[model samples]
Target: MTLAAALAAGAAQTQTQAQAQALAKLNVVAFAGASNLAIWAGQQQGIFARHGLEVALELTPNSRAMASDLYSGKYDLALTSVDNIVAYNEGQGEARLPGPSDFTAFFGVDDGMLSVMAAADVPDLAALRGKVVSVDAMTTGFAFVLREVLGQAGIADQVEWVAVGGGAQRLAALLEGKQAATLLNTPLDLAAEARGFRRLARGRDAVGAYQGIVAAARRGTLAAKRDQLIGFTRGFRESLVWLDANRAEAAGILTARANMPPPVAARAATALLDPERGIFRDLRIDEAGLRTVLRLRSKYAQPQKELTDIARYIDPSIRAATFG
Candidate 1:
């Protein structure tokens, strides 16, 4: 072949290959817990592959820490509390990231609620006043949650928030009354109730609707790989919809992947579809929700330029994309 002709052919091939690479693989990580199994469903069901992409699922210890690692390039996307992303971006709450937070959520996963599960006969939220309560992760996790919970119970200033690691330890504290009331989630919340822990409502009872875990890419990663981010969100959104529509089957997948006991996983699955606590509603980023998050995060952050400054951290384009 002529040199010019050969060069043109090589260029054409390179262009095609680059296009394929642009539409390549995607990787995401989830917060460590049983309820986060929706991400597992996406992987197990080949939703990512069906969308012409590859996905990797990693499990991080908690939302805040997972979000911080997301910024450091540890994961392309994080399945964590939507509030953590908002709080980190607002430079408030338990966010360890310095500078203004710049993370944005792509799609919703689950809606998790916090419950004040205390020993039976301990009475109501007001009853815990003047006593110490246990939180999951000190600054970021249930501490921020209880501040709102306590305030709603009309006794925020009266109670002290203490750390008790994850749910198991927190349950231990609540059982022994070492801590007045500790945050508990479903399955555990139901289990706590069964174990004589008085159920005193949940975050949904007090705080209306909030997205639990969301698929988010760090600002830099999203900027560099917008295509991949879009593809990943598409797969995850489909997975969420599929899980909702096929609850019984989805639960079985979660049961196998997460290794949670069948009955416990079943309860968690049912909660995932409940209109009150489910996170699968349209997956759009609620401006009002973000504003509410800003107000809440502001309560945790250093006083600066008020809640308006909090708006700077969230970029909603990817979230907007998932709607279509």
Candidate 2:
């Protein structure tokens, strides 16, 4: 019996080492834009480090691609859209092609700012009534959400598409005076304004349901490192808590990290942090937000689902961890 007990202890030690190696250095990724600035801030401030986590901030642009790589185990964690999470979980949109799996969301980061910017002379979102508007996304891409944004601005049917992707071409169209309007947010939008672009409606101005980024782990990771996940969330929320308390200093961190002017970073931080303008301001994956997405998707998107059905996609453990 003593010899058997010794053997069991040794096996437990080996398993512990394997688990440590698998979770030790976490490879985390997010979009390569202003929307994911909080990830940058937490890294710069060593929040992840303080929590015994080593994180790498991979720069992924295509939102779907990020979700794919993250879900397939290319990366251990990701800061990606709640929309993408729902779409993937329900086996709808692109996720349906590959079948859904069990995954969990960690934290609610920010609401996105998918906006339409145009030439200085284009009067308003209404003015884009028949003019060209380019986006990096396709039909139901961020552009679709922007349509709702434009609607709230009281001009949904006005703007037309021009096929300029969200990042550089959106700016190029404005600089070359080719497209009438394009959607963007800082520091790209900030740069555009400095170069003579006009600001139209922001996504936050368009709908109460804006894009929310999540920190997700494999469902296995949740079961294994529940405490570690809790620690990471606590550290992340602390960084956000710090941002909430020290707006000026937090803006400074983003401004320098983003290489944008102070005022530009300030405005970006404001939008990134604002409950109304920012994405993750609430951080609570409430029923209302899911209902808005589900209701709109039922109309404009295919494989339509009900809010109650999609609400199962949210784990809320991270938010609950923070509050509890």
Candidate 3:
């Protein structure tokens, strides 16, 4: 190569390295589901990179691990149920943390399209009576939602409740006939139904407006990595908007990243982008939905006092700064 040409190439490489180094990195963990389409799309389309952020996404086995990892600083942020943030913050979580839990949700994702998927032979809720049911934890995630469904079915006292970990694990047990049913979200629920499991009820239908997953981090992390958090939150919001506008691209993403069949992936993408029941377009926490979460926790949580304070689990300043 010529001397001037080689020098120009070297300078360009140095500039690229500098730009990459300037971008903040965030380690994020979330439950495995199609709800993570935004994250996957963001990474694929370079939305986060364009926002001066580098993201590493990992799928957690269960909420307990997500909680413990966050507490120990293994991850910078989490996409989890707002219920989990409330549970850990209120000392009602399944896994006890090392110190006082200050987990907080900073952004809303979706109303957890939680559905109770029962065995094929189990025709209805009545068939679930005297049968085994699974949950991520007895105290976190959507356990209370499942409880409410059974109670409404008049079989709350009859079914055996088991802590079976995350959606993937719970789905496994259900498929193997080890558990009769469990609350599943997104493509997992869709996959279950496709496999002959019956979706007995949806959480929203059983209760009312419900808050599902939210972007969260510990208070210390929030304060420490404020810039990265803002970038991530902004990137996620942009990703959602992009996915809504680009259906074909989103279907491809779901099929490839989520390991879904083409048709199921397309359907999952449609479900996530639905105007009413899909992801929250504005990415703002729904007050009524949060109230539903609080109400359910208030009724089912152990040693529970009435929990009505929505602000206790959310940090809104970041969203304000990012969007404003």
Choose the strongest candidate by lDDT. 3
Q: Which stretches of candidate 2 lie over 4 Å from their true place?
A: 1-23, 33-35, 95-98, 101-103, 139-141, 150-178, 185-188, 209-211, 245-248, 274-282, 304-308
Error of 2 at 310 (Å): 3.9
**Tens-digit per-residue lDDT, 1-324, candidate 3:** 599999999999999999889888899999977558999999999999999998999999999999999899999999899999999888888787888899999989889988999999889899998899999988875999999989998999999989889998998889899999999998789878878899988988999899999999999999999988988988988998899899999999988987778888888888889988888877888889999999999999987779999989899988998899
Please give the distance, in angstroms, between residue 116's alpha carbon in candidate 1 and its true position after superposition: 2.4
Poorest stretch of ten by lDDT in candidate 3 = 30-39
Can you give the TM-score per candidate against the true fold?
A: 0.77, 0.77, 0.94
Residue-level lDDT for 147 in candidate 1: 75
Q: Local distance difference test, per candidate?
A: 0.67, 0.65, 0.89
Model 3 regions lying over 4 Å from their true place:
1-16
What ranking of all candidate models by TM-score puts the best one first?
A: 3, 1, 2
lDDT (Cα, 0-100) at 65 in candidate 3: 96
Off by over 4 Å in 1: 1-25, 32-35, 93-100, 165-178, 186-188, 194-196, 209-212, 303-305, 309-311
Model 1: C-alpha RMSD to truth? Answer: 7.6
lDDT (10s digit) by residue, model 1, range 264-286? 66876787666656655566555
Question: Per-residue CA lDDT of candidate 2, range 8-85, in tens?
Answer: 999999987775466546677766455356556667777766776766677665555666777777887776656666
Residue 80 lDDT in candidate 2: 61
